[model samples]
Target: MPDPAANLASAMAGAYNAGDMERVILLAAQAGDEADEGILALRGLAEQATGRYDHAVETFRQLAHQQPEVSAYWNNLGVACRLRGDADAAEQALSTARSVAPHDAEVLYNLGLVYIQQRRWPLAREILLDAVDCSPGFVEARLQAAYACYVCADNIGQEAMLAGAVNWPAQPAEQALILAAMLSTQGDLDAALHTLARARLPATPEDERLRLRIAAQRAVLYERSNHLDLARQELKLLPLAALDALPDDASQARAEGWRAHAALAMRAGTWADAAALYRRVLALRVDAEARASAAFGLAASCDRLGRHGDAWQALDAAHAAQLEIAREVVPELLAPDSQPLQVAEVDRAAHARWRPLVAPSSRQSPVFVVGFPRSGTTLLEQMLDAHPEFRSMDERAFIHELTERMEQVGQRYPDELANLGGTEVEQLRATYYRMVGRVLPDLGQHRLVDKNPLNMLCLPMIMRLFPQARIVLCLRHPCDVLLSCSMQSFRSPAFMVLCSSLQRLARGYVTAFEQWFRQVEVFAPRVLEWRYESVVEDLDRHLTELAAFLEVADASPMARFADHARTKRFISTPSYAQVTQGIHPGAVNRWHGYREQFEPVLPLLQPMIDRLGYSR
Candidate 1:
């Protein structure tokens, strides 16, 4: 006859396998102190399955105590602790599990989850990257890493992680849909559309839902790529109303389609249609980010329809939603400590302290376009980019990246700029050009027009490295700038955190310009101020001046900027749609429409307004 203990273990194992968790627990309880490691382990797993996390944690803790070397016991304890809302305990157990099995992917992934649960995004992405390296087919780990990248608004990081999926042998339809959307965000519309096509496999309802998602994303991409006809065709196929027709989880896809339609409607001057579409998206069960974006779109639509009160309310909601996300997910953006690169809260004293220790190099310096956000920098960039003599890269962090290298060596940027030697200067300058080459390969005969709006804060650094570089200052109505900045749903942390409120945004603008004004006094570099209202009033006049400033062969090419824009894969700014519409006074003096909302911020913005020569 079989041993009694062996027989009982076999019975309990059968019960556990059959998902008879209560019976498994009962048998384990009856065995009590007599239960072996196997019985205890099975019972602990059953507790976890039944959501008895506290009981599971205790059982796993006991098992771990009995067999301290067993990685599974420690891992189980970690999972149970995590599910029970004890991140500290989960981390402790997971760290123990990691120590026992250093290369264990499951332990690593769980550790990543602990950080993710706490909203420590950067660390979560790094740990999740470790998990992916430890094991193949850890697709969940990869997806989580991509999500972590997105949370911090690291577009480059997100693109790189999602693109790495190509190394995998195959991906399920559901996974493919997400990866495609990631590519689209990085301005690779063709690649995104291609990936979407491959995701249309006839497998299951989830696959069918995945196809629906693919179509939704494709519609948005089509519109971005300037294939409006196709975008309209794709949108007409969607707009799922019935609960059963669309998955409850298809909120993401549905929102994308709705927002695309809203954008299209706005472009067509159908404010009512745009407002309705935005309301449809707002009604969806989506996250804070999507909600923020929909609200902003609604505000814009309302503004066009002369619903100033509703527009103001929508903007308030949008900013609140974005502020919530930034505060919760990336608190460092609000008041950074160590990020000397992106931690650019520069002021007058800081600007005055800078002295150019690095002598100007003979190497050709790219022309710099500087302004605050929503100040017509993109409009200028596109017009300049339309010229055959100039090329513009997407808004880049190369300046931040360059300063990061300085921070890496325990040197602060402007503070240390006064002390740099020829060797260090050559190294930093080389690094800057190396980054430019990586993006555009060869400028050839064309001059690179570097357009990062906030690079105004880095003027001392720019002037120090390339004193002879010509800079274009795009000036707009201060009130309009603050209003537009508040209305946008920018992904960049600097904008998200700083533009959270009109007061904060005004303070930031004043501070940035104070830094700029001081740099102008100190450096006395060649500068041209292009007032935005003046440019819009006479596009031809500004185009001529721009061509003259850059020494372009023909100003006529700049006139076709709208046509040039449509051929681009995508425009990477909020003005993407507006740029294609040609020169229009729609945004000029738009702050007047929201004058009531601007009243509070007027005192803060008055000095800049008067200085910029805009009427009060």
Candidate 2:
């Protein structure tokens, strides 16, 4: 006869495989004192599969305690804890599992899942990559890695991850859809459509749902590619009624389809249709992010349809929803004290204290284009980029990166600049060059144009780094700047929170301009003030002057900057659409249309307006 313990273990294994959790637990109990590790493990797994996560955690914890060397027991414990939403405990258990069995793909995958739950996306992607490397067939780990890459905005990495995972596990259509979205976001619309075309869908119900998702993504790709009619046709095939008829489980996919339709309508300039579709999406009661996005889309539609009041109200709602979500996820960033507006009285003596120690190098210095956001910086950069001798990198945080590097060396900003030795200054300068080189590698004898509006705050640092660098300051009417900033949807949490209110926008404008004025006073001659109104009203004259400032004679190519902007594959700025359309005088004094809205903030902004020499 077979041994009783062996017989019991075999029965438990059969029950576990059959998903008979009660029978598996009963069989394990019957084994009593003779229950081996396998019997206990089966019971633990049954408890986990049946959603008795606390029971499973206790069982796995006991097993891990008894067999301290067994990685499987620790891994199971970690999985149960993760399911219970105890990321800290799960991470501890999984890390211990990894320490026991360093090469175990299951352990690595579980640890990566824990990181994902904690929102440590980079770390999650790194460990998940390791998991896939150890076990190439690990489809789940590969998918998780792709999602992490998407969150980190690593489009290339996301595409690569999905490409590697696509052939595995019967080529999941979900992964294909994600790959297409990543490609589209990276401005590779043709490749995105091709990816969707090559995706294989089986006859299963799940595959049917995936088919809808694929169609939705395809429509978005068409819209982004400026094929509005094709996008509309694709959307018509997957109508909102068809999406609504889907099962409750497909609610997310249904909502996504509606959003895609709205985006297509928006692109087609059918504002009413877009508004209706966005309203339907909102009625689905999706998550805060989706709701915020829909509200923003609705606001845009209303704005296009000449419903200013409704547009402003919708924008307010969108901002509120986004701020609520941001508060939960990144409370520190949304904190009132996070970005304190500098309103200290200008100290001429303090400004004069930090003298430029580094002399102007004979080497071609970089051009810094900075001003308040929405003040024609992108237009200027695009025009400058049109010149053959100039290569302008758009809106990079090189100054912030340099500040962080400076802090890393145990020094504060302007205060520490005075004490830095020649070698330290050169090292900091080299660090900046390395950062710049990463974005623009072949800067051989060409002038580098770095355009970041917020660099106004870091003027002292910039002046110290490159004493001869040309600083082009873009200026606009303070009211127009405030209105434009308030209307646009900024990705930065700080900007979103700050610009949400007209009062805050005015205060921020005042603070930023005060700092800028002080910096201009400190660093005269190097700073070139260029007005947005002047540029738009007299493009030819301004372009000529701008070209002259760069020591480039002909301004002919600069006048056709919009034609060049249209050819650019990627532009990471809010002015992407505006720059492509070329210079428009309509934006100059456009604030006059919303004088009623400006009345509340006029007191705060009028001083700056007059100071900037704009006729009120």
Candidate 3:
């Protein structure tokens, strides 16, 4: 009997006060009810608040469609769309809202968040900055802007952005990650470790997400500083529960922790431990890339353990995984030839392309001591690292990985200076930078000494990347190299690929190294061939010559080579424990101990032995 207009108004008022949605719906739908825009908005807001996302979305979409001038309705619709994972619809709705409400701080903030999800870093940065300008106190906008800087690897921008966020009323989780990142950038390893140790975050809390991130970041920093002890300790503290919470997410904290743990073990020369960690990570997340890495680690471990069969299995797994990944993107890029690729042939092509790239960046006049496994590459690297100014990045596979990625994309050689398009070149360059950046950053003062013997195949690639990169080819008697390689039970892919016969081993080396040397002769004139015998014969003389060639001014450290070797880290190769001790001349001709065993390979290595001028 009551007037319908008054009844509707009373119903809305009661719904607003008591929050009873059924009565409001009934009253609003009654005949003769005076339904207005304000009443509709109230209904929409109530529906949204009560978790009726579908109904609320429909109501807001209709209202916005009917009254295109109402920016708030469109903005609300965008929020609903984004909540429903309809980013495309959300973007359109948000764009419309921005057109009508260009200066609205709330809408700008929302737009910035959408851009963040879309990975439009530049646009996100701009929108976030605009949001901050409109409302300087908006914490979420500033936080997202800081994250954008992180994505760009803009350390300074990250610092400035995070400084602003830290001053805001930040959640504890955010505070932990920001502090960890700042500490890491500044290279305060121990302090960062301690900070991570005391970190306390609430489980089942939103901020806890940031806490998980902080743990992972801190683990990376620890690994970088070569503090394997701390890295392993800290990684164990991460929330495994969070990984379960994100079962569908590939970038889970648990998976990252496994990688960090494996890296720590790798750095600490614990191949078995590293392999175990990699396997655990692969088990949880069967990603191709991770599987390749895991297989490689397992192979390396098995080789170190002198388990030849196990090592081969691991290597085969790695090769299969790598080939599979390569095939996905480039089916035509064939696998490395079954018959061991002649190193010289591969090197010739690699050097021609790589020389120019390496030449300009060879600031420290690096000495690359390369040869087959057990052929004294590690010893050469250690002797080189003994010199104070020459910093040795021992056996880093950055160039190999970089080249493999390039080869996957059909880029043949690094030194040839091919004229690929900007986008194609950019993709290759990005991968290379990422790979190398993983190991070296701001390596200004010291001469870079990379001794990845396997990289002997990609000397041409290295030369192209670092036209200034000096190559130091480490040579030993073929019989000596082969004998040492076979007896040592070497890691797969490195030494095991020679197929166990001293003959195969010698042939593999001859094929690989001959290709490497031939390519160098033509493509690189800055190379210095060093005999392992000469190094052990007169450590100081060889080192001084090396120091001068590498442009390392300080040769006094050569006098303390014994002391220098004692303090170095990550010596896992066969020469590890040996190089860590005083230089002994015993290994120089130890192959004589098994001369009869070396007869078969002796013939295959005759040419290299003659070329390298080694006495039989």
Candidate 4:
């Protein structure tokens, strides 16, 4: 007679393949003490299919323990653990499977899935790419890799993945949407629209939800392309009533629809409508980024309605939510009191060793615009950008990038600058030029304007790199600057956390300005102290002076800067809306409206206020 265990395993496999999970489990149990690895594997897979993850995990764990060298057993265990929402255990099990079968495509794919579940996008992308390379027919792994690229904002990688995925059998609608989003981000609106149109959404509820999400994303693309009317039209396709009728399980789709509507409302200056819709968005259990975005929109609505107190409270919530998300993304950099103190210390040491080069290099030196946030840097940059010969980069971290590059190459900034041989210095300078060239290419006969506000902390580094660089230090009333900073939502958690409280905002401002004053003493006469009030009150006068300082012959374009600003795209600052609308003198003393709120921080800001020539 045939072996009982062998016959039972064969029956179980046939039953499992025929979707008879119950029969598979029963046959598995009938094997009893004679149950071999094949029978146990069948039982585990049946349990997993039937949503009995606990039983599946136990079965796979026992099988893997009995046959420690079996990659399939470990892979099944990881899959079961992942199904049960135990990412840590899943990662461990999958890691073991990877080691046991280093070239196993299935094992690699499972481990990459676990990493994606853990939000380890970079590692997941690497592993998933390996899985695709090991087995080019792995459609699931390719899609997962595309998702990783989307999360990491690796547009080129995402495009490559989509190109391969399109050739796969039975292409997924989700993949099409991902391709559309990536194309939209790259400013290929026509291609995005085409990709989205080709999406084959099924009649299933899941696909319906995807369809609604695609509509929302298309609206965002239109908005980014400066077609606000078309953006609103796209959003209108998803009926508000239909979105509201979605069940709790479809909360994500509902949230997206509401957020899209709210964005249109905000753009149209319908503050009340935006406020109501954003409130609905916040009520849903959305991701942290979505919640933070809603909170920010609500704050903007409140501010426009003259609800200053409500606006501040909403802004605080938004900043806290964003900071929490930032902590998850960069735990090391989110430590309290780390960034401010680090910058202060580094700049102090760097300034101490500051020296002019023997002769300024022939390369075009960037015009550095540095100051505290909300201090009219954007205004100055936009004015300069309107000129034919000036090209401004909106709020980049060139200095920060250079410093990190120095550390990567076995050299510390400032301290290592003094020890650098001529060749090393040239190499470092070349690296800086290469970075700028990549970001702001085609700078034909135009002076480069680097316009990061927090570059106040990098003054010494700027001086060392480009000794002939013209530095414009934009100044505003300390109280106004602190108030505006506290009100605005910053992308940097370090800055957001520092300005979260009135007291901390005041103290941070003082620390930054103190550094600025010291840097001025170290590199005097090269710095132009441009006041925001002066720029607003006497635009022509200040523009003429600014032109003369930059050695430009004409200041006519500066007068019509707002007109030019409105026509420009890709404004990457909080002041984008404000600058496009033209200068508002009402922003001059906004602190007066929040005087009671400013009371806790006034003493800290008083010295800076006086030093900056602002009257109490």
TM-score of every prediction relative to native: 0.84, 0.79, 0.47, 0.80
Judged by whole-model lDDT over C-alpha atoms, candidate 4 comes out at 0.78
lDDT of 2 by residue, 1-616 (tens): 7788888888888888888998998777887766788888998999998899998999999999999899999999999999988999999999999999998999999999899788776688788888878987777777777777766544445655665342444445776776666655545566667778888787788876787888888776665554557777888779777898899878667877988988877766789998998888788867766778788888878877888888788878888876765554346656555553323222457656664575655236788898899998999999989988888866677777677667777787767776677788888878878767755778877888889898887887777778787888999988889878877766555666777678878888888888888766766637778999888778898888887777787989888898888777557676776788888887877677668888988888888888889867
The candidate 4 region of ten consecutive residues with least summed lDDT is: 339-348
Off by over 4 Å in 2: 1-33, 42-55, 65-75, 84-206, 218-241, 333-363
**Number of backbone collisions per candidate:** 0, 0, 34, 0
Residues 1-616, candidate 1: write the lDDT tens digits.
Answer: 7787787789899998898999998888878789899999999999999999999999999999999999989999999999999999998999899999989999999999998887777788888888878975687787777878877777656755675555443455666666766766677776666666666466665655555666677777787667888888886666545223676777776787677778778767899999998898999988888899899999988988889899989988888888778776667666632121242443556556655454553225688888988898888888889888789986876776677678878998667776777777888888888777766788776788899898887776787688888889999888888888887888865567777777778777877777688768867777889888888888888888877876665899889989988888777788888788787787878888878777887888788777777778
Candidate achieving higher lDDT, 1 or 3: 1
Clashing pairs in 1: none
lDDT by residue (1-616, candidate 3, tens digit) is 8776666676787887787876665555663234676677767777776777787788789889889998999998887777767778878898899999998878887887787666565677777778777877776666676666554434444545555332344345645565655545533455545555555566654445555566677777755654456667667767455555754554545666666666666666787887776667667656555566666666666655556566656656665665444443333324344444324244444333432222245563445666666777877777667775667765665666666566666765553344444455446556655544544665557667778777788765565455566777777777767655554433233233344345555667777866776766766557777887777778778777877877667777766755666565445455655665566676777666566556666777778788889868
In order, what lDDT does every prediction score?
Answer: 0.79, 0.78, 0.63, 0.78
lDDT string for model 4 (1-616, tens) is: 8887778888988999899999999998898877888888899999999999999999999998999898989999999999999999999998999899988999999998888788776788889889878987787777787777666544445655665343445445777776666555443466677777778888787887888888887787666555688888898788898897788888888988888888788789899999999889889888876777788888878877888888778877887786675564445645555543346334455555644355353236888888888999999999999998898866667677677678878877656766665566667678776756755778777888999888888765676677788888899998988878876766554665576577877877888888778767766527788999888798888888998889889999877878888676546567766777677898998888788788887887888888889987
Q: Give the residue spans of candidate 1 off by over 4 A.
A: 1-62, 80-89, 99-106, 129-143, 159-178, 199-208, 242-257, 332-363, 442-445
The total of clashing pairs for model 4 equals: 0
